[model samples]
Target: MNILPLIVLFPLLGALILAFNPRLPNRLAALVGVGSIGLSALVMVWLNWLFYLGDGGGFTQTLWQWVTVGDFRMGFTLYLDGLSLTMISVITGVGFLIHLFASWYMEKDLEGAPGYARFFAYMNLFVFSMLLLVLGDNLLLLYLGWEGVGLCSYLLIGYYYQSEYNAWCAFKAFIVTRIGDVFLAIGLFLLFTRFGTLDIQQLLQQAPQVWQEGDLMAEVAALMLLGGALGKSAQLPLHTWLADAMAGPTPVSALIHAATMVTAGVYLIARTHTIFELAPFTLSLVALIGLLTLLVAGFTALAQTDIKRVLAYSTMSQIGYMFLALGVQAWDVAIFHLMIHAFFKALLFLTSGSVIIACHHEQNIFKMGGLWRSLKLPYACFLIGGAALSALPLVTAGFYSKDEILWLTFDHGYSLLWLGALLGALLTSIYTFRMIFIVFHGREQIHPHAGRGIAHHLPLLALALLSTFVGGMIHPPLANVLPAGPEGQYGHLIRVLTEVLAAVVALVGVGIAAALFLGRRRLIGNLMEAKEGDRLRRFFYSGFAFDWLYERITVRPFLFIARLHRRDWVNSLVNMWPALALGLNDLLLGTQNGRLRWYAAVMTGGAVSMLFLLLLF
Candidate 1:
């Protein structure tokens, strides 16, 4: 009777239908795909209302017992609380908007019914997996959803199967993330082995009793989980696959990379806060990774020429902030920023998609200019999203959530991390506006055509408003779900000063961008032409050459080993038994090749042998 299960079911059922009917008409396909997510969004709304109407506590639904073994049991169960509610609301709500926009965005990109239907099918499946991920009561179910999203990401990212480059990108994303998934799986195994159950609520309850605050197993488990988070969220070292992933369609970028899938890391960390709290060393490591990743990604974004790649690196940096919050124990604020980030980041990606389409598929920011008058909707949307992204003062939603993270970092005695965060913020502002200025403020390079219809306009306008201070007003209910953020001991003056500094840094970064990028400045050209500057540009443009380094270290070495084996030694081992069996089979075939005289002679010999054996016995 509960509507909670329906929130996940609707999209799944839609995916099944669309998958079975690939030849379904485009309009009808759109109806099924968009309508399914729309339905889920509606159910989320109804559930949110019911949650508030009730005692405002957690809810769990056990559909049935799924599996049982010696001293272990699992079930088809779902859990709901303030944390999951926010996640699902974002998944279904923002997800529906993305799907609606995709219906329009994909219209010209894809032709015929099969293409449309297939695209919708993948989208629906992804939505289903994402909902299941946030709703599952147990780690197994959550892992299922987690892997499901990864699979769909590959399929959707390589939707243009005709392009070999796109296919390889999908493969790269898949393989890179699989390494992280293996880490997550190992962590799950470690927890289950120690605690004897994968039920998340039970794990949280029992971990404290079973393990000391600094237990080795706990730290190792936490570390393994962090590995998974880094890969999924595109943090440093494991972050090479994300920018190449931009080869996919823009909707795929918005949905999988920006809005929903990338945030899974933050969700995983927050969901398992109790375990992380036990491992202080690992907890500090989380913050350090975040700090390093943000700075790396921030510098990388500044050098990008492609519009989408800049956004891609920016995503990595923002997620770094989320991880920073997680490390510093601002769990609620991290989730808060995640929610706000989904709003503005989705807006920016979608608007960029619009720009790409308008310019006849041109994505280079350097190639675009002075189209603000022609494409006013996208221009305005970009400005709003960019401001929010840069955390520009009180006017934008990012200011509220991000400022909290900065304050908490400083308030909790991590002043060095706070300083690093400020520098990252400055970089964020400059790179973000650098793209804005170069793309929209310079002379028009090509004629443009703006997208029309409700799908294009509604999602952008809605997200634009949310990117403002208005979206930050809807507070997440985390008082009971997460530990309270640390109290600011440094009186009112210090807190005010922290906020003021962050805002000023953001503004100053924007001013610097304007000075350099506006009017085709001589300074930037001179700098780019310099030997060191050009080298740095090339380095950053290649994402610090992490991909190239990985190629030499992981890919080439693997290929070399494969080549030396000449069919693989492991394959030889497996083939030995089959070869032996075939040889015996060939020997038997030789005996069967008998002439009449040969048959008679064989019979006589068999008789003589039988008689001689009997006599000897």
Candidate 2:
């Protein structure tokens, strides 16, 4: 009956059970993970139904007082509102499906090593952390979730830690996120000290009052909080971690990039929309950064030939859309877009995973062609996912959500943002279809050894079907939670226009691929021939040296300083005083003798001096 505890406790219980029973059969362990997640998902669905029944009031369920200080109190509490409830549904619902898919995908991994239980353990723990993030009633609790997810990410990314690069990538992801978390933690402390409370609802109510009273201090506090959201959400400057996060398995990439972590930034902005409302300058910067990041990432996506890398760049670009919405104060529309993006993007990534596994680990598009005939299920899934992403019309999920965001940006006189977003949409369509055409439409450049089986195809089929129709069946209008837009009678017109634009974009993208790589053997050959051209190709392949720039600017400098510290010079000055103090202590001890004769001589000399002073007085 108590839904809040059940939501967090169930996965926690699963983690406990799996951690202890390490010897359980792989299938049985997977079943436990899947079944536990499924139960949690059902509970989430039930809660969603109940929440939907309520008029508009939000709900809070306080479990107990977690800690108490002299005059401060924090609790183990969960807040269920329209925003958090939507997040819960996505985390547990889609999360369960991903777990089910993983049961099959990870089986091969278990054949040589018994990591099945361990994998499930990580998944279950990841779900619990995500729920905490969404359901937390206070900033401290939210930070707990934030750190928890980062820990799970590190563990899962380095799941196959035998590889040096996997381990390095995992560490990079962990440390980079921790950099953002530090700012987030400081912001939380400032909120508590200034407001005397960590409760989110109370802060929202008080922030505006503090602002109206000319509280410069409070505004600075809010800006500090924005820094955290920017980093977590992968806004412009701190966005490099996400691109490197793709170094994990495809499933990890899907869960983190498409469905969960990347959305954290948007959720943070929405959760603290009150703060943004007060700082108009910060809001504008948020929008501008989103616009710039989207354009940059979209161009990079166009240049990528690796299937997963393309999806990774696309994710950065799409999250920019959410930030754009946030900048314009369309918090609800941003959230709506987030929901739809999760469904389709996850669909795309998982389907892409299936194709990779079928191809025996081949990743380059040039190395894959004529896959449509052999990989019918994956092909179908890709098409559906691509359609939704392009926002091709007829009331698909992405169309409704993305169209709303674009319209909101335009309505707010952010014509430039609208234009940038529209171009992003077009580029998204082109690159997606480019991968589709070159991989499935052109010549059969099959690998010498390719494996095809039912295990890989089933998940792809299920996700494909969901991708196509799930967008239409969910809640309608989504107006209750998001800001209310004007209700119009132009439903048919909207649908027609959206469909036409989406189709044109999709066709142009597909047509370009056909023209360049389809039947022109000489063109394709010559393009691949020039060794000098290879250097140019490599530049595109390397993300235009953005990764290198980050390393030189941030990563290398960080490591260099770390090495400098180990050299015992940068910090040796700090030790100088302590070392001098110790030497003085040793020197002072040598002057004191424990013998009675030495003590007597010193006492007699002091007494003689005292007598001389007394005579003078």
Using lDDT as the measure, the top candidate is 1
> After superposing candidate 1, which stretches have Cα over 4 Å from the reference?
111-114, 485-487, 567-617
Clashing pairs in 1: none
lDDT of 2 by residue, 1-617 (tens): 36768989889989888989878898789888989988999898888777667775667888999989987888999988788888988888778777877776677534558778888888899899989998999988988888888898888888888889889888887877777788888888888877899898999889887675335665666667767876677767777777777777778778876788778878887887777677777778888888888877877787687898888888888899888888887777888788788888888888777777778777787799989888876787788888777676653567777777776776677778877888887777777777788787767888533334554555565556656657645652235444553343345665466456645665576566566656654664687578866666667667667778888988799898988777586478888899999999999797596888888988999999999999999
lDDT of 1 by residue, 1-617 (tens): 28788999899999999999999989999999999999999999999899888776889998889878876789999999999999999999899999999999999576443489999999999999998998999999999999999999999989998899999999999999998999999999999989889999999999999989999999999999999998899887789889989998899999999999999999999999999999999999999999999999999999999999999999999999999999999999999999999999999999999999999899999899998989999999999999999999999999999999999999988999999999999999999999999989888998999999999999999999999999988788877789885666687789999999999999999999999999967899999999999999999888888988998998899999988986887889999999999999998888886598888998999999999999999
Give model 2's clash tally.
Answer: 0
Off by over 4 Å in 2: 213-219, 447-459, 476-503, 521-540, 558-617
Worst 10 residues of 2 by lDDT: 476-485
lDDT of candidate 2 at residue 270, scale 0 to 100: 83
Give candidate 2's TM-score. 0.85
